[model samples]
Target: MNISWEEIELYLRHTFVTARESKKNVKRVIVKLEDDGFYGLGEAAPSPRYSESVETVKNFLNEFNKLISENMSLYTTLQMLNNLNGNYSAKSAVDIALYDLHTKKLNLPLWQYFGLTSDKIINTSFTIGIDTTENIERKLDEAHEFKVLKIKLGCEDDIKIIQTIRRYTDKPLRIDVNEGWKNLNKAIELIKYLEDNNIELIEQPLPSEMLYENNRLREQTTIPIFADENCKTFEDLILVKDYFDGINIKLSKCGGIFNAYLMIQVARYLNLKIMLGCMIESSIGISAAAQLASMVDYIDLDGNLLINNDPYTGVICKEGELKLINEPGIGVMKIEK
Candidate 1:
């Protein structure tokens, strides 16, 4: 088998403004591997907050390519990479690519391997980024086609934004504070307001590492709280089990599909809701998560699919919904080569 890696930049259609940040571009790695005439492809993204970079992942890919020659399987490939880099975005790229490679090699879809339901349409939430109430209202109007909306919050007036959106549409709403909330008092205040407006869930209003703070905050709210940055690995599970109502399993953050599934199993055992999420890549990466979305309780995959210049194809997301192709190897066609 031969392996190749390339980094590409993806531009968002509109400015993607989060609570603490705004991004105009997404940097991704495209992994290409060939065995005889058959081929497999995978994708991943790097964010400095997660300690990832193009040069870093490429260097890791070189090491991963050499390890594959030693006949390490996908499950152990993650273990091997973890032995090298201690679980970062580079590890996840190889982890997912190998899963795509494994399923394609056996000529079976990834969902079957994971025992995921074959749901053709996975409802997604269109994100309403942090901005002026008027900007959010305008975005909601433009995003009228979506049934579920996720509002990003970081300000003292976030509850007003939710209330403003409620006036536009009574659609199901999920708010992600991205650890922008300062303390339990303010978080509880915002939670009460959101619940009054019929918001479904709130994500990581407090910092990920604030186990005590988050647990205390969880006690004060009726709405579910889903942990993103906190639940990166299974070892962190016990610490957060009582703190969060759900977990957002991003394949990139947890290292790969193997660990992603492991986290889901643990979350299921704890009777916690599962949210399959992504770190903003093209359809190739989104489809990777789509293969897992059907098995989870919630999905937040509209990230990369909403971008204007996603350069690959394997899935279709229309108006805040996902439909993955039933083709072999994640159904992605490499655009550059």
Candidate 2:
């Protein structure tokens, strides 16, 4: 088997907003593994907020590919990859692509190979980035097709934003702070203020810049706090075990389906609420995560499908429910190299 990698530029149909920032573009690293003339692909979009550059991730992948291609088995490959820090998304993409090939070689559906057989579909929350109260309300009114609404709210004047959104609908709602809240005291205040109105949960309300403080903050909120940035890999799981009520796993963050599978088992044992999230990639990445969502507790894998301008295929987000294409080996059309 041989592995090859490429940096992909996926254009977002529109600017995506979060509490900490907004983006009007797309960038990704797609890892492709070829063996016996068959190919498997996985993608990850590197974010500057995570202090990652495309080249940094690519160079590391090059080394990983080089080392693994020298005749290392998957287990050995995993050990080498785990020894590195950061680059979780890059590693995840490569891991996913490898699994894609492995499953395809066996002529099996990925879910089956992973020992999952449920036809359970997950209702994903459509995310509305940090926007004006009026715009958020407008989007909320238009979001009749979704069952849940997840708004990004880690900034100044967050109270007004949550208050405005509450006035619009009483539906189940969640918020991703994106490490925007500066302190635990502030995050606690924000969660308490929004709890009764429409807040179902708060994610990463405290900043991840400080592990001790972030963990300390999670203890103060009654509404469950999910660790996103702080819980990138299972190894980091121990650091956040006491601080977070749950952990959000993004295929991009965990380095692919294989490692993500491992994380789920460990998280379940540790009693962590599992959430599956996504980056601004195409349907390919979303489908990979969707396959795992049915086995987890929360699903936030709608970022790609929710864009008004996604011109790819694989998964569908309708009626707030995530539906996979139901094809084998990720059910994706290969990106033309």
Candidate 3:
């Protein structure tokens, strides 16, 4: 097998601002694995909050290449990769590549290989990043095919943002605060207000450290609260199960598909809802996440949809629904530049 990676710039269609940072262009690392005249692709979109960068991912991949030799079994390769701590995004790139390679070798679509039925897949929400009301309206117009919208909030004008979007469309809304809110009382009040406005869910309202506050908020409100920053690994699930109604599993945060699969099972065992999400990535990454869509109650794999320049062709998003092809592996092809 041969391994290599390169950095690519992902240009967002609009300025995307969270409480943490604002981004117009994000840097991602694309990893490629090749063996026996077949190629598998993966992506690593690192987050600063997670302390992962292109440099770190590249270094980890370099070390990973040194540890593996020819004819290694996929299970052993995955186990060896799992043993290396941190760099979840890096691990995700490798994990996805391996899955793509393995599934292609078996000539089965990833979802089918995982025993998931196509009808079980749900609609994905298009994101409306933090922006002016005028820009928000434009973004909404651009997202006409999306029946669900995920809004970025946590600013002083958060309520106004919801009100502005309400005037345009009645689509079910999901709000992500990115750990922006600090006050529990205010968070509860805001959540109630959002619920009244047809908001389906609220994500990461408070910082990860405020587990007690999150639990109190969850108890006080009827709306489902999802843990984003609060839940990174499987162990964090125990701390959040009492507080959050569900967990948003990002491959970058949990190390990749292998761990993400485990996280979904554990969440199901605990009777918690599951949402598969992604960072600002290309089609390669989004396609990888989409493979696990049928296992979750909700899908937020619209990262690639929000971007203008996606260098790969993978999942098909139409009429707010996510559709996967019957092609083998992750079922994505590179778009010629």
Candidate 4:
């Protein structure tokens, strides 16, 4: 096997805002692996929240290339990734590409490779990033095709943001605080206030390190509290199950499909709801994540949908439902940008 990668910037349709920061564009690295007339592709959309950047992803890929052998098997590659210290997002690219290439060799789609039926796939939630009341309305209008909306909260006027959204549409709402709410009492109060507003769930309301505070908040709220930043690997699931009602598993954060598949099995055994989420990515990343959609309880693979300049075509979202192509591997095809 051989590996090569390049960095590209993805522009958002609107300025993407979360509790932590705002961005109009995000940088990502596209990795390609080829062997004897077969080719596979992957993406690394590293998040600053996880201490990863384009430079870090590229550095890891360079080291991985030196370590990977041409005749390495898929399982061997995965084991090598497992032994790697950190850089889960960087490992994810190799994992995704290996899966894509291997599954294609087997002439199987990734979902079929997992023994999952296509009908088991569910609708993915479209995200509405934090903005002014006016911009929020505009964002809602743009997201009209999606049946469910995930709103970004954590500002001073958290309740007001929901209220503002409510005034425009009655669509089912899910809120992600992105670890913005710090005060346990205030978080409890906010969840209590949102109980009647048709909220489906709340994500990472408190800080990531505040496990006890999150557990306390969960004990007091009717809405399911999901762990995002706090839950990364299979081990975190065991710990977070005691605090959170669910976990948001990201392929990049968890080191891609191999790791995420293991995490899903453990999450189900722990009786924790699974929400497959994504960073701001292109179709390659989104499609790779969508392959596991049938196994998760909820889907948030709208990272590709939020982007205006996606260089590849893979899984597509139609009215909130991710439509996976019947083609082999992760079903991604690069197009002229």
Q: Tell me the whole-model lDDT of each prediction, alpha carbons only.
A: 0.77, 0.76, 0.90, 0.91
Candidate 4 regions exceeding 4 Å error are none
Candidate 4 positional error at 5, Å: 0.4
Worst 10 residues of 2 by lDDT: 303-312
lDDT of 4: 0.91
Clashes of each: 0, 2, 0, 1
> Can you give the lDDT of residue 259 in candidate 1?
77
Cα TM-score per model: 0.92, 0.90, 0.98, 0.98
Q: How accurate is candidate 1 locally (lDDT)?
A: 0.77
Better of 1 and 4 by lDDT: 4
- Runs off by more than 4 Å, candidate 1: 70-79, 335-337
Candidate 1 lDDT tens digits, 136-243: 778888788787888888876776777778788888888888889887787777777676776788888887667788877778778899888788777778767888
lDDT of 3 at 138: 95
Error of 4 at 114 (Å): 1.2
Ranking by TM-score: 4, 3, 1, 2
Looking at model 3, the pairs that clash are: none
Against the true structure, candidate 2 reaches a TM-score of: 0.90
What tens digits encode model 3's per-residue C-alpha lDDT throughout 1-337?
8999999999988889987789899999999999888888989989889888999999999999999887987899999999998999999999999999989999999888889866664799998888898998899999998888999998888989999998999989989999999898899888888768887888999999998888888887888999999899888988888889999999988888888999999999998999899999999999988988988888999999888899999889889899987899999998887
